[model samples]
Target: MPETVFEVDVDAAPEEQPDPIVNRWHPDVPPVERVSPGEKFRVECLDWTGNQVNNDDSASDIRDMRLDPNHHLSGPIAVDGAKPGDLLVVDILDLGPFPDNEWGFTGIFELDNGGGFLTDHFPNARKAIWDFDGVYTSSRHVPDVRFAGLSHPGILGTAPSHDLLERWNERERDLIERGPDDETAVNHETHDDDPPLALPPEPNEVLLGDMDDEAVEEAAEKAARTIPPRENAGNCDIKNLSRGSRVYLPVFVEGANLVTGDLHFSQGDGEITFCGAIEMAGYVDLKVDVIENGMERFGVDHAIFKPGNVEPQFSEYVVFEGYSVDEDGTQHYKNANVGMRRACLDAIDYLTNFGYTPEQAYIILSTVPVESRIAGIVDLPNTCVTVSVPEAVFDFDVDPDSLAEISSEGRGRAARPS
Candidate 1:
């Protein structure tokens, strides 16, 4: 088995005890409350299927799947005074992958099934399964690559109001009965224009047909809506949400209902497998806190990255880091501005007491946080997003909240090592 080692700055401070109110597990377990800006959590996540399946499983096992109760989430921690029309700011501190597998992968893909662009050519019902050895074998194809799927939760959100949760739960129960063709169940609107490709493919085959074009175009329109962004995370792969970046979610009921089970070791850009990096066992630590009225137009997202690597990681595949200010209102705003650079600075300042110089910071900032864009600008009142990274390469030791205090100009000056 390949050793899943987390390589980065490991000199971060030790964790403190969790708060009782915001620290309790289960959404219904606590009442809702308000959380201040820059609060954070270390969410424990399970495999994409919420640990319903495992590394040693086969396609037959998940084909008729039923998730276990324990696999759902760690909490629905309440943020004090959180109410309607408010955005719940969830800064993702770091996502620790199960060290057993170098990467995590799950089953399922967006366009792979008949629902996506290459539906005509890729007609097989697929299944993605992996073991600690970093070997992945699909439903019908032979294992070829030594890729380990890094697992991250496919679903991470607050519990809707009691009524809303009940309604949605009822709908979920009957989803299988209704089937996919049901008009009420299936609603899709298409559009045009697409994103540019970054880091061209390294001489790969074209056997998958015109999937590239179709995905590029179709993914644009699909990303416009809110619910879908929550469904697949706006084209974000599995192993994101590691270090540096933070995830902001709008609190629905009282407690910011939170849960994370989907785990992935490593994943491709599009998550073409419909699954994430891997499936394994691990514990996700969390520090549930809040941000005041975090909702803003054009949606909100943060950038994440470890100290060694310079580039930033965004909430989804498209958006770049440093696109906006880190509540400090200092970074310049570009027409296609992504806050990746700012986020990287946020990460660096927190992890290393000796911060990077502006020159060193800016150069590395632009390299990462690719596909910069808004994953969801409209979702009723507030929008939520994630900043992602590969766990293998990220590690941090500072409190991200501290970065929000100093002005952007003085972020460097005020950031002194503890």
Candidate 2:
């Protein structure tokens, strides 16, 4: 346990934490603490939604979730002497659930609110409560599934410079405000069933740590929303950023104000369900160093990482494939979004055959360490995507011809909003 720089009780609201967390990214958001290069520190975080969602049967909390003020982050902890043109070297030394609170959640947010990758097929809010036992997690809401947690902070990075922040705002505003036309036809991979095109900053529920009201007044509206991954690596949800991972985050400001939160107990790649990971309020043990002039030295414009050694040990999988085509069978050319969506739908349909409900399967795919790979993105007229699940997660043999299966006769929809 490194020195706990930021601590919080998950039951407490974000603003009430020992070191109040920030929900949006801004260069001016004052750092709550400062650390020298190579210092090891611990940061406690609220769940991504700041305890808004809960551990219960009904998903009414998820359904009524407010979109703004998400991903409440633990710091803008300034790294001493880190400056623009340098790289912030970060090592994810350790991560895990709080011992007393070892349960976490995965949910499909309502289509009208933070819609997921497969929102069209499963539109309403739904949830799965996964309880951790050692490193493995199993959910009461989904059946015949258990796997080791691939825990990681779903989002984290160095703060963007004022200029970089402006660039982010301009880019998002452009995307959110853009209408269909010739340029869109050539460039946009937009789809009706895809995640939101862009998320612009919302000041309505902005949380900017312990910064005074006067500074908050000026920076709130300009702070970048935490919903999308930009150059700063804000919301990548990369599952492999677990223990021992080292990521080089681009520094665009003096002191490299580092922020991290949205801890996950486990997550499949793509995090297809939007709020899909087994999100928990937990702590991250980090050791950070400065790489002066390394951004240019490495030609790095975005956060780059190498995965750590902690991973699920499932060696075999039941693989499902999908191509770039709509549910209506309309043709698409090299569209990974359409292909991935179809692959998820394929997996959902397969599980329903073994007696798991579609909603249950949906949550399984979201929370477990399943592999969602873009098999072929440049395959001419159609892109190919694949979703592969570990054979061992289920209690029964996955081979269709060999084993008995759970009966769908009495099964019902997974947890839904009241």
Off by over 4 Å in 1: 1-42, 67-71, 100-152, 162-240, 286-289, 296-418
lDDT of 2 by residue, 1-418 (tens): 5999888887787777778789888888888999999899998888888888877888889889977878788898999999999989999999888889899988888878888877778889888888899998887777667788899999988888889889988877787677443222323455665555677777788888878898888788788888888888879999999999999999988899999989999999899888989999888999999988998999989999989998879888888888877677777677777777888888888777666778888888888789988898676888898999888888666665543544545334333323
lDDT of each: 0.34, 0.83
Q: Residue 264 in model 2: shift from native, Å?
A: 0.4
Off by over 4 Å in 2: 180-196, 403-418
Q: How many clashing residue pairs are found in candidate 2?
A: 0
TM-score of 1: 0.42
Q: Estimate each model's TM-score.
A: 0.42, 0.93
- Per-model C-alpha RMSD: 19.1, 2.8
Report the error of model 2 at residue 284, Å.
0.6
